[model samples]
Target: MIKRFGVSMEPELLDKFDSFIKKYGYKNRSEAIREIIRERLIDETVKEGGGESFGTIVIVYDHEVGDINDRLVDLQHEYTGLIIFTTHIHVDRRNCIENIVVKGKNSEISALAQRLRTIEGVSSVKLLLTNYTYK
Candidate 1:
């Protein structure tokens, strides 16, 4: 069952929300609001670190810097249980991008991302956790 309720906000905030809905191509304010609420709930669940979560860690790095390739390989090996697979792309002669798909406890996944960030030559590391869990 769906329940409808009234939400009151300042005019300025409502205007901004309307603009956001239009920019995102949402059919209406209700649809956009539903998605926003779902995203927030998922984030909270993942942050609680009580259950398994799935996510991808994307990293960009300069291959020429230090022994980064070897370090990255070793780190991934250490978390073999958490990592599902990884895809590597050669962005340039000296740079590479890696997308690592992982599934495990939220804490474990977070730990892996943190370890990856500490490796030398890593220019960017983005960890995107989702609510999906594999059985």
Candidate 2:
């Protein structure tokens, strides 16, 4: 079942939304609005920290930095149940990037990201959570 509702906004906002629709190639306002709502709901659900969520933790680090590689491997080993798989990329001779796919409670994922950020050589750590259902 689908329910339709009305949204009232200022002309300026509507103009900007129209432009966004065109920029994103949305077929119409309804499609864009639906996506926006869905994203917001998913974000809220993930933020609540109770439900299981899927996300990727991406980290960039200098491998040569004191014991970083060993520490990184050790930390990841501790979260074997949460981690689905990890893809490591050698960005250069000294730097590496790892994209870790994980599925667990929001708190667990967040905790893992926090731990990754504290690693000595880690220059960047990013966690992006998304809804697990794919249609």
Candidate 3:
């Protein structure tokens, strides 16, 4: 069942939302609003789950750190069932960025990303996910 209700907001903000809807090619305000709500629900659901999740982990680090590359690769291999693919790019003379896609329990993926970020050379890390189970 779908329920409809009026939403009050500042005109300025509403204008921007209208522009966003136009840019995103949303058919109507209601459709755009529904998508936003669904996305938020899925996001919150993913965060609340202690079980399975699918997401990408991005990291920036310095390749010059002692054996960091090998260590990183080995660590990912250790979670072979979870790590799907990794894309690597050499940012500069010493810096590098890697995007790793993984699927597994949230705790497992979070722990893996945390461990990688704690490595001596890692400078940044980000995790993005969208996994929800109705059951």
| C-alpha RMSD for every candidate | 2.4, 1.9, 2.5
With candidate 1 superimposed using the best TM-score fit, by how many Å does residue 111's alpha carbon deviate from the native? 1.0
TM-score quality measure for candidate 3 = 0.80
TM-score rank, highest first?
A: 1, 2, 3
Instruction: State the displacement of the C-alpha of residue 78, model 3, in Å, after optimal TM-score superposition.
Output: 2.9
Q: Which stretches in model 3 have alpha-carbon errors above 4 Å?
A: 132-135
Please report the TM-score between candidate 1 and the true structure. 0.88
Q: Write the per-residue lDDT of candidate 3 for residues 1-135, one digit (tens) a residue.
A: 878899999999999999999999999999999889877776666567565777899999999999998899889888999998999998899999999999888778888888998888999999886565532
Question: Model 1: per-residue lDDT, tens digit, 1-135?
Answer: 778989999999999999999998999988888888888877776677667778899999999998999999999999999999999999989999999999988889888988989998998999898876421
- What's the lDDT for candidate 2? 0.91
Query: lDDT values of the candidates?
Result: 0.89, 0.91, 0.86
Q: Report the candidate with higher TM-score, 1 versus 3.
A: 1
Q: Which stretches of candidate 2 lie over 4 Å from their true place?
A: 133-135
- Off by more than 4 A, model 1: 133-135
RMSD of 1: 2.4
Instruction: Provide the lowest-lDDT 10-residue window in model 2.
Output: 126-135
